[model samples]
Target: MTTFVLFGGTGDLAKRKIIPALYSAFVNGRLDANFSFIGVAREALDDADFRQRVLASVSASIEGSSANGGGSTPATLQAFLALTSYCKIDAREAADFEPLKQRIDTSGANAALFYLATGPDLFIPVVQQLAAHELVGDNARVVLEKPLGRDAQSAREINAALRTYLKEKQIYRIDHYLGKEMVQNLLVLRFANSFLEPLWNRKWIQDVQISISEQVGVESRGDFYDHTGALRDMVQNHLLQLLSIVAMEPPVNANPDAIRDEKVKVLRGLHKFTPEEVSKHTVRGQYRAGAIDGKPVISYQAEPGVPAASRTETFVAIRAEIDNWRWAGVPFFLRTGKRMASRSAEITINFKPIPYSIFGTNQRNLRSNRLVISLQPEESVELFLKTKEPGEGIRLSDVALNLDFAEASTSRRVESYERLLLDAMHGDLTLFVRDDELGAAWDWIDPILSAWQGDSEGLKSYISGSWGPAAASYLLAQCGSAWGEEYVED
Candidate 1:
């Protein structure tokens, strides 16, 4: 039997994401009947009350599942509800782990996972308590959720603390983006298909664009978002990880280290940005009051609990490059923002335009061939290829060869957390980030953060529903490029 323990079981993350993911995994037969869920929180709720709370959450989240004929049957719900147990514990106190140890021993499951869904401040203390109580055994694994730290130094400190008790192999640093089906398929899209491998380098690829936009502002998380901003919250973990996948060389093998080794190389290859270069290549913005989909929205500063003079950037755009051979001179444009026109996460790899066109100037209007991998709203891969328009004219038009992941499969697409949770249970490290990977990412990103600390030169403002600030467009224009049209349409 496998036992899953959630350290912050009653919090929003555990209730809204963790429990629902577990339910999905349970429904799909990924979780066994002998499995147990021990939810630990400081709220002091009993097993029945915790179950009731979870049930209500599950009911609301799974309502959409029910609409699609995927709801849990009554018996299935009862059986799943049976596997759950609750315990109240102060994560910081070593003595409070007594109940957890007793429950694990009584449950008779050697495989255990401690999911630290709590705040970053509590992570080290909880681990210390688990170690003190001998609750961390050879078969135990600890899963960490992100915004790991504010910067490189803090991240290193957290890593050092965890290393005291857990080895690198026993730690799973979750980056939910890597668990997305389409994001994983990027590996297959690049490596599995021989057709794309030829053009996956700087010689044929002109530029790369990675965008993560949100339609909604910080409705409830304004307090948390006030301090973090766009770069640390999104770019550090999610966008950079995606960039690594797209730019990394072919790994020696599909093993965890093999994949991560290539990823680290990409991160290290990232061209170091000097203070002057930062001003030229980076653009930061805060969204002001405007309308999104005809609904009025508040600015970042206007959000509740946020100071009026906040300099926190709700949007970030950077034109970066890797100094290595495979990606040298090929610019990578990364952008992320809140209160954008639409919510989307995608990467577009634009191939260089055909040289010395034999078809003459008439066909020059055709868009460049692009391979877009979209991760959100829907998971899909689209190839934009130039084709002749249906007429006597020799004009060319770009058409997409699309693969809709959801429509092609009868099996339900699992949420990112669901796939990640199951991978954690099975001791799969492929999707989980390694310590050095995290370190390397922060090491490269810290300079950009430092450059923005006291300077306000390039910070611009954009309307809430806009694509981003005008400077983002200017950054790309200097490279004779532009943001992909997907952002502008919505």
Candidate 2:
């Protein structure tokens, strides 16, 4: 038997993501038959209440993804619930963990996986309590979620503290983005294909763009978002992790550390931004009152939990470069924002222009080749290639060769958390972040944080439903390129 313990089990993250993923894994028969899940939180709910809540979350999530899946039948759902139990413990009070220790001891499971969905502040205390109670051992593992810390030094401190109680192998720093289907397939797209590897460098590629846009505002996590903003909240982790996968060299082998070692090299190769570089190479914007699907929305400053004069940026666009030879002189544009045109997470590779174009007129708008890997809105990889317009004299137009993963697959796509959680249970660190890599990412991001903190440019106001501020476009214009939205490939 294997047991999974969830801290902060009834919270929003758990409800919206973790539980749904677990249920999907269950319905899909991904979990072991002897699996167990124990929900831990300060709430006074017993097993029945927590089970009902999990059922609700699973039901709601599955309803939203009707095209993809739903929960199992009543008997199956009840059987899954039977594996669930709840424990009430104030994480701050060490002695309160005795009950949790007893629960783990009495659990018939041969191994345990602790998932800390609680706030980062409680990470140390929770782990410390577990270690103190001797509740964790060689057979037990723990998964720590993101927003690890605000900056490099603090992240280091957290990493150090975690090391005191747990070995690096025992800790899984989960980045849901890494577990994304396309993101996971990225390594395959590069290493598995001989044709792509040679052109993956600066010689054939002009620039790369990674953008993650959100149509929704911070309605629920306003207080948390106001402090975090787009930089620490998105760029520091998700965007950078995506960048690493896009830029890393071919790993010698598929061993977890071997792949991560290559990834860390990409992180360390990031060209650290100077204050002037930060000013010129970066753009930040705050969403103002505007419409989405014609519905009105308030400005970031007017959002609840936000200061009236907040300088917090809800959008960020950066021109990042790797200092290594493979990518030198090639700029990787990273962008993300809230209250944007639509929700999409994608990585785009812009190839260099043709050395010679004999095609005329209608081809005036013809551009170089581009590869768009969409992570959301749909999972697809679209390659845009210039082709002669049929029934015409050498007329050229760009056509997309689309490979939509969802359309091509006979089976359901694995949810990020579902894949990641199972990896944690199996002690697979391939999809998880290594401790050192986290520090390297923060080290690259911290300078920008410092520069933004000291700068007085304030936040640029962008209308909601728009892509972002004009400056975001301007940042790209300086590099003689634009966002994927501005340049459409047929």
All candidates: TM-score: 0.96, 0.97
Give a tens-digit lDDT track for model 1, residues 294-394: 99988888899789999999999999999998888999999999999899998999899878787887554565788888998888999998788788968
The deviation in Å at residue 359 for candidate 1 is 2.0
Show pairs that collide, candidate 2.
Answer: none
**Candidate 2 per-residue lDDT over residues 24-102, each given as its tens digit:** 8888888988898899999999999999998898778867886225546777778889999999989889888998788
Model 1 CA lDDT for position 330: 96
TM-score of 1: 0.96
lDDT of 1: 0.88
Name the candidate that leads on lDDT: 2
How many backbone collisions does model 1 have? Answer: 0
Which residue runs does candidate 2 get wrong by more than 4 Å? 67-71, 360-362, 488-490
TM-score of 2: 0.97
Point to the candidate with the largest TM-score: 2
Predictions in order: lDDT: 0.88, 0.89
